[model samples]
Target: AEVCYVGVTSSAPSSVARTPEQFTQKLDAFAQKRADVHGQPVSTHTIVSPDPIADLDDDLIKAIKEVGADLVVMPTHPPKNLDVIMPSHGGKVATHTNVSVFLVRPRDG
Candidate 1:
């Protein structure tokens, strides 16, 4: 089974969680919402970053490496001009990491 780490980042000086139970409760709520939307059980390992708000691409790559993820799925907005579309953080991650990335661009409504 693949381990999913739900990362939570905070920039505050106090990095330690106030209460482990409270932290777990919030994470559990998020997991439940995800499961409800997907209509399937979701297993997640939670992570609270000590040093927060680093480069998003670097953070994602670091997280991927930590979990040894074989694949990554990221969502992007549909671009009007495919040729001129700017590279997103997801794109950077794919470029830098050996792991495969599957980018999903939802159809523009």
Candidate 2:
């Protein structure tokens, strides 16, 4: 079945405490739940990788293709300002990957 892949890049050492398999499973469960609610079929794969800011686009594309992902969904942190051209890992991935990508903006409080 075609699956969705979520790539999470973090610089925090503590974030690496969880195994990749564990993280993937959790994401799968969450996706399953949402799919179930919507009466749709969906599968998820999660990749936890260290930040590759210099070549983040390459890293994300590699991960997405490795999982045979049909689509990618990512969340962005709040932007500091309108003029600020904040570097985005998601943006990089979107620009580089061949597959479709969806960037979900964070809710403003």
Candidate 3:
């Protein structure tokens, strides 16, 4: 299967001091490394928006549609409060997108 990594970044000025080009280069390097390890070609796309974090699912859905992806695999973290019904970014994406979504939770310490 082919691999495409999409990275979203902020368009608004930030204190992080990293240029969009630098961020894109970092994403490319990381994607290349993963591609090398997986022994497959990996393409990368970087999206610069005013508030990618707030619209995470939107960006993800857009990228998936643009790439014509049938499935999406993304990392997700557990909610801080179990009582809250707030959906995670992955959950929001899954609900909004037409493709299958695979959410992987990271191992806790």
The lDDT values for all models are 0.66, 0.65, 0.83
| lDDT by residue for model 2 (13-64), tens | 4464356666666677878887777777776645455764555566668878
Q: Which ten residues in a row have the lowest lDDT in candidate 1?
A: 8-17
Each prediction's total of clashing residue pairs, residues at least 3 apart in sequence or on different chains, is: 0, 0, 0
What TM-score number comes out for model 1?
Answer: 0.60
What does candidate 1 score in Cα RMSD to the true structure? Answer: 5.1
lDDT of 3 by residue, 32-99 (tens): 89988989988888888778777777888889989988889999886678526777888878888898
Clashes of 1: 0
Over the stretch 1-109, how does candidate 1's per-residue lDDT look in tens digits?
3436455444343344465445656677877787777777655544455554555667788778877788887777665465367567677888999999888998857
Judging by TM-score, tell me the better candidate of 1 and 2.
Answer: 2
lDDT of 3: 0.83
Clashing pairs in 2: none
lDDT of 2: 0.65
Better of 2 and 3 by lDDT: 3
Better of 1 and 3 by TM-score: 3
Pairwise TM-score winner, candidates 2 and 3: 3
Per-model TM against the reference: 0.60, 0.61, 0.86
Q: TM-score of predicted model 3?
A: 0.86
